[model samples]
Target chain A: MTTLISVPLGEHAYRIAIGANIRRQLPALLAEYTPLTPKAPALIVSNPRIWRHYGTEVHEALTQAGWQVTPCLLPAGERYKTLRTVEKIYDAALRQRLERGSTLFALGGGVIGDMTGFAAATWLRGIAVVQMPTSLLAMVDAAIGGKTGVNHPQGKNLIGAFHQPRLVVIDPDVLVTLPPREFRAGMAEVIKYGVIWDAQLFDLLSQLPRLDRMAALPAEQLLQILERSCQAKVDVVSKDEREAGLRAILNYGHTIGHALESMGNYRLLNHGEAVAIGMIAAGELAVTLGYWSAEAAAAQRALILKAKLPTTIPAHFDVEGLLALLQHDKKVQAQKVRFILPTAIGHGEIFDQVPTELIRETLHRLQA
Target chain B: MTTLISVPLGEHAYRIAIGANIRRQLPALLAEYTPLTPKAPALIVSNPRIWRHYGTEVHEALTQAGWQVTPCLLPAGERYKTLRTVEKIYDAALRQRLERGSTLFALGGGVIGDMTGFAAATWLRGIAVVQMPTSLLAMVDAAIGGKTGVNHPQGKNLIGAFHQPRLVVIDPDVLVTLPPREFRAGMAEVIKYGVIWDAQLFDLLSQLPRLDRMAALPAEQLLQILERSCQAKVDVVSKDEREAGLRAILNYGHTIGHALESMGNYRLLNHGEAVAIGMIAAGELAVTLGYWSAEAAAAQRALILKAKLPTTIPAHFDVEGLLALLQHDKKVQAQKVRFILPTAIGHGEIFDQVPTELIRETLHRLQA
Candidate 1:
């Protein structure tokens, strides 16, 4: 039941392996991708919760396959995604004597993946990292792209690098362990893939009997969602690894989503949750600007609602604060926030000159 | 008379502009290399000492050329080169609203150039960094290479990135204002270029009447040293940008140099002074290992002495401490310290299995 999608990024090209029982394939896959060198150990970076579930099996698997493994536990959650977290990983890698030939295995969700990826990026300039994403959000989005970074107090992803992993291993079996809230939050990015590039995925998501829980979806549908969403991201990232251009569409909801996540102190809203709200705002802005049909916007909203995702700004959210944060968004060009506005159900375009007044008015209308 | 050496690194290609009174040409040179876009300000990262001397003139030139510039004053010294110093540059860049097209001008010595380059490499993933190296050390070596990083508590340059600058503007006039000890230190790297890459340059250096002070050298000779040394570095770096193989030769004296620099707490010996001592150690080790003739080693030592540089290990320096630091060096491949030993004045080769006993004996004999 292994499905492989190749992300063709020239020298950095890698494959995304997805399935239910693919966790067992780590040794074979790691060997195939990056062969183990003598005395070079693999450092597995995971949070306590995820490590508690899969650490022993993974350790045994790698050890049996002939790798000296060192496990590093990181505190779970977005709040712990900082330079301090990266420093600890550096300490572990150095302590374990992970050489340039060694690989770092990121074995949790997006937080673990980002932190570990950034550590790999700066450790001895650059080293190999293998992404073993356990969450849907990471498998289809975060771990697929070469983007790796940590948050600054001033903003999210303020410190980072573009270090691609040697391989990405996605295990759907791990998703069953994810909470319903987290599963639904991950759906936000899945839905974004539909709106930005695949209208068929958008339509398929709308017809699901249940979208809130992983248990409710058929295995076939889950595989399709993972493959198509990953394909959409791979299709984009392979063209532009460093976001020189054409990659702005991948950041469809991130400009507003990052502001929301930062304003909430990364506690009030998870990444996917904030992006869900951001997409709604962007959809509304698109409709108001006459670029998207009202029917398309309504259909998008219905799908997001069906997924049990938030579609409105937080009730007590401050418009001015959001706007201030938006100005600091990394997507800002010439001091103007670059918004990826929907032109149609399956397309989005970069609109850089969107007036602040337009944003203000939209935020005012969306606020409860 | 500006001498331009184009470092052809494919997409990252840039030119080194070397001449007297070239500080005035920064505005025009910057325009030629990376044009200043309206509303995107250039953030100048420099120390108080260098900034106090030439900051205003450079500021006026950029401002008069239609760039909105922001100046950030850093504490001057190698000890201040750390992640904390980079945080301030990020703050200032963010404060000034620097964007992707915006450039960060490093307007001091190697320390300033390295810090600014690292800040730019991480800020917004990366931005353009323009190297304006004031000191002789920075102009000839640090500023020419794409290596950017800061000292980690564990080691020097333990964390960093290979970020090439968009342009390098070298103003030799700044060396006139440089202190005598600092001038002597800068000559160490210049001397290294001669020992490792160019015999003609070595002979030219040996013919100098006085090498301790900047005023003692003829202006034509000074310009030749800067240009030839920079050209040698450019030839190496353009071929091997990330030190995969060939560029390791550029680290001729760095194996011991870094250990000396680190053991001294980066205070007792500055980068160039430590390198001067390390070169002497490396030369002696080469002779002991039968890789180089004693005549060549003595010639190397004579040039170092002619430049008024130290030719022996520091008195009371701990041999064990320095040896321990050498093992942790980034150049250590598979637990063996990779040494670049000279076979002739113009050539050096990478030798990996230099016996630790040989190093021990060399240190014991060279000790004051």
Candidate 2:
């Protein structure tokens, strides 16, 4: 069974088709929602690792659907997510003569999705991009939001555009190949949905015995996690496509998470791992500010621990450095860092006036 | 007197304020349409030549309006319209700690407007961009539309996004310093508006005793040209924000114009000069195809000549070379060149099946 979550962004709205092995249904799915000209050129952008596994399947599927398919593979990892990397995609796009009606398929994790979406966004001033997220992190968050961009040298995702994907195909079967560490990184976002928007999802995640690997959960549970997480993203993005207001809540742990990733040079911690630690810090800050109960914060930290995600900041990190990095975050307004703090286990709200001293104390306490 | 033309793109709609020395009124105009946070940072993007002339005036005006102003000056001309130049803008934006609320003011010709707008469109996933066109070409054409991008190594505007400006300020007074060749180049697009959408504008230009220089026309005539040209742009763009349909009509001469520009290596011929020659080719093609009459085509040629613009392709351009370049154009749809051919002086239509033979003959006949 397929769970289709429709993101209601009016004309830019698209559907998230979540199922096991649903990558095979891409042609039919696209035909229904975003029908293209027969044999229109489509570029499949992925890294070697993801491409080695599923590139042939997607390529053949698109070709069989009467679409001309070309492959553009790039180096895998968050480090390669830069404008220079996007230029490589542009070179491939130009070589393929990809037109305005053509589509670019993002066939990897968040990094690939971002670069591909951005290339598609700017190529010919805009083109169709279909998100085929292989990693759990991409499937649940990056692939659905239409927040496509590449990292600047000084910051992560500092340069980008709000170009939504035409369709997002999430196949859980592919997560079997996702490394355990990568799997856990995706769980951080899944846990985020539970804390910020869906308490039921949080409770369901808590009920699971282990979430460190895909094998730990039943097929039904994995589907539920993908569905609920994607739906939560759709709910927020559909309401605030440009992060004007409500969409900022989706950055529950991202403000500090991004700074930590940058501070670590994007190597010390994977995005999910950094986010996990950031969530712990935000939870503690909420409790310290009397916004959220200590019991709720404890439960949140315990859940992260169960997922084998980090709940403490690295001891080498200084509060002042992290605070300085926070000011550079894309969400900063008038020099105030906007943080999404949970008031309860299931609800979070945007706070632009979070006291820096409180954040410093929280970070100091969370040092590993 | 200031002439206002509103581009109605729903929420993205903005107004074009046209007058003499309207640069001084930018602060008040932005306050009426796009109110920013007090003392919000604004990056003024211009080339050294444009900056040396009017940069101080714009900077001081913005500074007095309570904007924290920073100037990012780049090399002038089309060759500098590349992603590398945009990177300079990104670096400057980063240096200023430009937030999502900050605005980028493009204070030069088409090159500056395009690069600045593209930078704003992608900076922090997009911010505000106000187009302060300092050239006649930019005022009547590039500044009015949201088509913003830098050229790819392969083609013009191959890498771009449709990012509308918050406000467009067109100051005719700035044209005093514009070189004669540059002024005539702008007449190409002005004649385009007359041919494609406004016959009245065409007749008005036809009646102008001399269409080559600013001094040749009265102040009222200049304002009329600016107002009518901007209104024609607004009329087409409001209906088609993206070049999905009616908007392509604006590319009347651009199909061949872009190809010719590419053939000249973007150095031999200015955009307006290439476009002037392209309009002649398109007019001849329309006549040959029986979609338009020879008399009407002659009238267009006469008007272009009156503006002292080129009416013939350079003798060195071969038909085969130009044809091959057309395939790489952003407007080519599914291996077919999409040409905007004139049906009459005031009306034009998109033609995707323009015969290569006819274009070959048209080029053959127009060789200088």
The most accurate candidate by lDDT is 2
Q: What is the lDDT of candidate 2?
A: 0.90
User: Which lDDT tens digits does candidate 2 get at residues B14-116?
Assistant: 8899988888888888888676544567799998898889999889988887889899999988888999999999999999999999999999999999999
Question: Tens-digit lDDT track for model 2 on A1-368?
Answer: 77888988898988889888889988888888775554668789999999899999989988898888899999998889999999999999888888888899999999999999999999989999999999999999999989999988888888999999989999999998999999999999999999999999999998998888999999999999889999888888888998889999999999989888888887789899999999998988888889999989888888898889988789998889998989878788888889999998889999988888888888889898
**Lowest lDDT 10-mer window, candidate 2 chain A?**
A33-42
My TM-score estimates for the predictions, one after another, are: 0.96, 0.98
* Cα lDDT over the full model 1: 0.87
CAPRI verdict (incorrect, acceptable, medium, high) for model 2:
high
Error of 2 at B90 (Å): 0.3
Identify the runs in model 2 with alpha carbons over 4 angstroms from their true place: none
Model 1, span A12-47: residue lDDT tens:
888898888889888887767654443677799999
Candidate 1 chain A lowest-lDDT run of ten: A30-39
In order, what lDDT does every prediction score? 0.87, 0.90
User: How much is B192 displaced in model 2, in angstroms?
Assistant: 0.9
